[model samples]
Target: MHPAGPAAKVIATLWWVLLGGATAIFLFVAGLIAWAWYGPSGERDEWGYVIGLGLVFPLIVLAALLAYGLVVGERLLPRPGPDVVRVQAEARQWAWRFGYDDAPDRETENVLHIPAGRPVDVAITTADVIHAFWVPRLAGKLDAVPGRVNVLRIEADRPGRYEGLGSEFNGPGYRDHRFSVIAHDAASWDRFLQGDAP
Candidate 1:
């Protein structure tokens, strides 16, 4: 529930909504069980309970969840923006390489630097087997497939450091395939772009 960016916020909200839907379903089933065992004897609307409560309600809830996911997924895409920072990410067996669009020759390994409060579009690919790019507090995961690039949108609301990792089980060294994200302020970002340590 500790979300540091917009995408993470949406995902956290989705989790809460899923929990609520599950709770509602559980309560409904429990109510049905109680009614079946302890309620006063009467001719219940069997069709109504079976069709309306059992099928229709669940379908409606599922449809709503799907709609919400679609909308949220669209919003999280790496859309073009004036302030968007583009970065290239290449995943290997147990390492990550991050290169900036502004500084093409400069690349960082296992340490990604992004400006705070701005959307970043990371173009991800893999050198070998498929891997997953994930920064849990910032956004969802995207596969880094060989010979194909996948763009994942991520951002930080403020200047801070966050943890990132490759989530796929590519090899025995996968457990150490971790990284860090340093979200810098405007000045810090500029300095880092100009050859200063972040």
Candidate 2:
């Protein structure tokens, strides 16, 4: 078999990177579309469109690098570690409760603590009428209904404070069915787990 020439090798590399990058970009775009159209109010914004545009050029550069790695040489894509967290939530007549596996006994009212840069799975269920759980900054939303559990995944890329509002109208307090999501590092997470906050 003949060895690939320099130009051929480069072209192949570019193609491979392009494919990977395109895949990533496609997923990102899909998320954006879901967010803008189907996601909650906070997700729909003109700034998101602008931000999407800004990412195009950089995405192209990464795609090129990925292509080069695949065609010209073998490169291992760095997989982010398994840093996913799960927070189970239950909906009752007039409130929401959050619990972590390690600390299931502790319940927080309308406040959820999650680790940043990690995938979070929220299993939601309702004790009564249907309720929706939503957090715009992290990801999309899902419904919480009686006798059923809904799974929602969120990945907060950055650490900060975000808001979550129930998209469903249940009762008079439906408007008050809002909460705050606090994304923190490992240290803060530990503290929260220890019940050190108000």
Candidate 3:
């Protein structure tokens, strides 16, 4: 049988690999921020914004998550279950067709509809050359190979429209291979499933 959970190991591995570098950069900037602001009290005024974020926002979030991870341990991982929305994204010559279980009649072309705050599981495979599905605001993109299906777990906390781009340069018009993601509230999601425009 497959792993019992949402393959948290894979997600965590990917997260650290991608964010580790960014975290280092953030820490370096944060240190500069502190030195500029509080090191002298005769602080570097130009770093005012960075210092503020270092003290309160970025570090705070990192701490909170660290604490949670330490406390909850394995429970912090996402579990595989029915509630996880599964999306099958198929890429053709130049467009994306997103198929969701709730929308069986017709695939949403060029638009991905997801319910905000819920876990979205995507099993992506390309019909042709390699392609990558990337939505920076929500989650990192994974490669979609012709014969292999890659699974991605994504969660969008806010309800809004976000942009997704195809990172792999398959051929011509690669730049134009982009789509939009629409995150909706529960009620709006229901309406959308019922064929209502959201």
Candidate 4:
């Protein structure tokens, strides 16, 4: 239900699947324990249970989950694409400075603009202490450390305004550190890039 973009959809699906898998494993183990304790005690295959159920089951389940999670994570990475938009997000003090690749001189404070229905790669960095860039409705969170740039891929399915924030506790003013992302239509985005729209 929180799926606003492709990456967000993938992440939400992974979360649900992981929760389902965890619930299934819990119930299975609980039922098995109940059966073993309440049922009639006979000659049990100690080695078989130990090897097959304990070791093999956990290994197989963990391996499958790991593989699935890695695949999902790889899919969410910022891949090279022709239509991908690039922007710079620099965190300092309690504000976000956004610079568009299309416009070198143009800069916005605490507000980011992008074209809707297109992949946007945000190169995040910090000028001062460590902070985090998080836009829950668009994509996942990534830390912004000094001297390091971490790129995050985000997209919006439609034209709207999405809220973003600095998730790390860099200082006392971090509580009010917030931003907004304005996803514009194709024409509006073009106008905005040409210094027509704000």
* TM-score top scorer: 1
* Runs with alpha carbons beyond 4 Å of true place in candidate 4: none
lDDT of 2 at 41: 75
Q: Per-residue lDDT for 117-189 in model 2, tens only?
A: 6667788998899999977555555899889988776655667887888879898889888888888777877
Model 4's number of clashes is 0
Colliding pairs, model 1: none
Q: Where in model 3 is the C-alpha error above 4 Å?
A: 1-78
**Candidate with more favorable, higher TM-score: 1 or 4:** 1
Note the clash tally of each candidate. 0, 5, 1, 0
- Model 1, 61-159: lDDT tens digits are 878878887887787777888999999999998899999998887899999999999999999999999999999999999999989999999999999
TM-score of 2: 0.57
Task: Arrange candidates, best lDDT first.
Answer: 1, 4, 3, 2
Off by over 4 Å in 2: 1-81
Error of 2 at 106 (Å): 2.0
lDDT of 3 by residue, 1-198 (tens): 111123334445546644764576587777875666567664345556556755556676667656655555454344698788888898766888898876887478889999887889877888888888877667656888999988777777768887889988999999999999898989899888888874
Error of 3 at 132 (Å): 0.5
Q: Is candidate 2 or candidate 4 better by lDDT?
A: 4
Superposed by TM-score, candidate 4 places the C-alpha of residue 149 at a distance from the truth, in angstroms, of: 1.1
Residue pairs with clashing backbones, model 4: none
